[model samples]
Target: MPMIRLPSVLLLLTLGCAPAASPPTAASPPTAAPVQAPSAAADGLDAEQQAWVDSTLASLTLRQKAGQVVFGWTGGEYVAADSPEMDRLLEMVERDGIGGLVISMGLPHSYAAKLNALQRRAPVPLLVTTDMENGPGMRLAGGYALPSLLPLGGGTSFPPVMALGAIGSDSLAYQVGRVIGREARAVGVHLTFGPVLDVNSNPLNPIINVRSFGENAGEVARLASAMSRGIRSAGLLSAGKHFPGHGDTEADTHIGFAAIRADRARLDSVELVPFRAAVRAGMDGMMVAHISMTGLEGPEAAPASLSPAITRDLLRRDLGFGGLVFTDAMNMGAVIRRYGQREPLLLAMEAGADVLLQPIDPREAVDAVVAAVQAGRVTPERLDGSVRRILAAKARAGLHRRRTTELDSVEAVVGARPHGELAQAVAERSITLVRDEAGQVPLAPGRRVLSITYAQPSDIMAGRAFDRELAAGGWTVASARVDDRTPADEYARLRALADSADVVVASAYVMPREHSGTVGARGGFPALVQSLATAGRPVVAVSFGSPYLVEAFPAVPAYLLAWGGAEVSQRAAARALAGEAAIGGRLPVSLPPRHPLGTGLTRPVRTAPGHP
Candidate 1:
């Protein structure tokens, strides 16, 4: 792989260490500072906190203690108090004594209200968490009151972590974490399963691509640790995830098993660097991925989340991570396909997972663990240790004092104007002009441009922001949307349309997804992008997702990378195209052979009308 072959080149691209010759000298985002000693959960517990944890753990019956380690899932949308779903969830809390919940997508007010209700019913305060990798805004896309007319409130949506990787701003990353924490806390969320610690060394990795900080382990370590600190500072627990590293694997654990074959030396140097940093940084939690590393376990590709050698020995005993250990979602294919339903939960406990997130069935999950403990398959001491950690984390988050969220405060704290501004800033700063050979940027305001958004049909938000920004500048845009399914005749039609326009702006969105299985542009997207390039019009290709897109259509004369498919990134790309924001971002990952790491061209902000 290019990542392994290009070690020397990777060192120079460390955050904040780009050479003087690189463009945009206007103070690149500050590099990560030296990490401090483990300070948060890793500090163990103060006497009062330990007492509370001990008392809480002691009070729980075997079933309740087992429930404390089993976290169920809830959709953040409003469920009437009398609804069956609410009844089921309430049963999980009241009857089974489940520890926490992993909330999926929903509105902010509804989410807060539902969580508040759950907290009120629980014997112990539930440790609410979500996969808010970007922020709560990522999952909370408020429903429209009238389809598209009246907009409901949602949380702040920042650009992806890869955008942070490209900008390399430790301060901005911290603020991203702060916004995530603040908004998440407002909605009664205590932990964000994020600041993905995966090194993103493998460009082919389908699930961890843009979710990871960057390819370089040290840079990933620095930025992720900084983000974790920011999360804790906002009074929310942060989990740096996919422990033992999910960066280098090609398969998505959501669908199938993936194995990392690196030897111990390579694993330590490349994969485990950020995790060690997280351990030292005192992150509140760590999630073990379902992927296996043969290098760590030897010969057999045992799933790390179910292997004691990886989670207990390597993570707990060897790494000394004192915080909570969460297993990756139990319902994923990596576990279920191999171990079936009930056995995985029992095995995860034995593997040393403190929290089993999103089990196939919470009732069965609780029973299985309770049965395992009774059978001595999992030790009673091991279960209690996990319960103590969970209770301590809840106490640390001040849940012991106040467990419920205020309904009125949800709208005020989430999706605040300042949070949106920060998102815009990160998006603007992260737009990297990798190749502008045609010099088509700073798109002339009066030109009749053909703007085409190439994305999955389901990516409804792909180019709306970009087109809106362009239209605001009074530019004539003959817009079209294309996906992998666009027929050849449609491409020919677009090619014909391209010839009539002065410049063709082709924006492609391709990112890591759970079941997508491949990072490359799917189906005919490469052909579609290539077709536009052959149109002879100076086609400016921009990637709103993976920066590696340039590798697929390397001949596209002009290229810009927004690093993600967020609306903020789309608007940022449009602004860069209009010269509204200075283009300074360098490549966080290499495209190989031609554009190595840190290859970016600078364009000064447009001064006056008609000026380049």
Candidate 2:
């Protein structure tokens, strides 16, 4: 845990009020009429826009200025604009003057309509943001459900950035970014909290598993930089998120504080690599994680979101990032558990955050910041600096001229046929053959296949698409689902089905999800698969989620990494299993000493004679 050291120039730039080294030279004679000094707003903004920003800032009360830094969430599902939720949100926009909205859950058209209505009521246009990590479909159901990042890299599967790292193609990463931006902007999303810069160095990390690009610093940096550029190219802002890096932590910050134990030197070399690359790539914004750096922040292990040393000094000054700085979410357990609700919001702004995202109580948080300002604990100049950055970002997004989305064009742009085709192609290419020790894959065309889908008991239909794809391939496929609560008798029935089948294809849907806290299979599912493999049934394990499943159940004779749980990923995996397509994906992250990084076994496309 070493301290971060900033370069002299960056330190001076970030100090905000460093004295000039020398007065204007005699060579540049001062005009007697008036020495009109350069205005602070003129640094990044044009005169007209800066004047407007200054006027707007002048017009706002301390409370309103505080509210401008607070961002609230909207699901965009309400059909009635007069609903209680809508009314509450309108109050936040019109009365509280909340500056931004993050689209948490919603339908495309309804979300657009709601945003338009909110915009009409607000004094200033809201800077709208969304997760949109995988694509607009990640949050907006009707939008193009781009394949999760791991599966998107190859051709169209929206191979996860990990796969893109494995493929080592910056161009492919750029394309993925472009698609993300295009679809996101179509739905009125201004910024995407994406291109997760965390280098998944720790295999046990629960939150950032496959969501991150990969373990190698240089590779992650290369791909993330390309993706950020693609997002910018699409006229939408891109955020390189969970910054400082959440890759090495084992805990999920959503539930509690996640600690990164790396020393400053280690962080500089590994964790901070992609972030530095992101800054160089001109990433528009960065979302600070609620992670603690033990070495940097001391034993209290303060979350980076509330740490000026981490956010302002390390990220802003040392790293030289001049764009917007965002907190991951003030509502997250890591923030609330330590600082309570209101204090974290004020602390985040003091730590150099321009946008206070997803506070537990938006109004209360704004009130606390305003009170802090009134009490002289927080300075108005500090508040104005963040407000200026937020406003500048909005202007950059063209929100000043047009804040609402075109509802009629959303459907045409989202989930467009060509994008679907591209997705399918990428998924097909990303189908990786991890192991084929027994040569069990490409099951003989007419063979009897038993497909077992393993998921939580709540997700009964999780593998329906995988089953459908196998059926469509003309295999005599029988599907069985096993969860944690399945009885011993159910296992007996499943074993009988596996015994009858010529080949057993098991789809392990142990994806990294919110609150799940683990990526490994649950409910003795892996044990059952192990039993089938022990019984001499040719078991081919296909992972629709974590690629590291092989490390958990190494006894499985054959293995495949589908990289995602998307329908396209399932179908592509099914096609690969049925010998209808090629299996060419390589492992993006290492499975430690057993299977190092870059470890996929390649196989040529196999189709029955005259089938192609």
Residue range 254-369, candidate 1, lDDT tens digits? 88889888888998898889999988878889999998888767767779999998898989998898889999999989988998999888888888899999897898999998
Cα displacement (angstroms), candidate 1, residue 153, comes to 2.8
lDDT by candidate, in order shown: 0.79, 0.74
Residue-wise C-alpha lDDT for candidate 2, range 1-612, written one tens digit per residue: 001122222110000001112211111112111111111221356666677677777888888889889998777453487789888899889988999988765566767788888998899999888876655555555222222212211111254555565556566567667666666677677888888999999878887887887898988888888877777776778778888999888888878878988889999999999999888767778999999988776778789988899999999999999888889877778888888888888788778888889887888878888898999988999999888878877776777667777777666666665666655666677777877888776776777888888876544346777889888878888888887788889888888877778898888876666666777886767888887777677999988777878776678889888877767777888888777877777778887666777888876676463243
The C-alpha TM-scores of every prediction are 0.92, 0.89
Error of model 1, residue 147, in angstroms: 4.3
Off by over 4 Å in 2: 1-51, 142-159, 607-612
Which residue pairs show backbone clashes in model 1?
544-564
TM-score of decoy 1: 0.92
Q: Please estimate how well model 2 matches the true structure, expressed as its whole-model Cα lDDT.
A: 0.74
Find the 10 residues in a row with the least total lDDT in model 2. 11-20
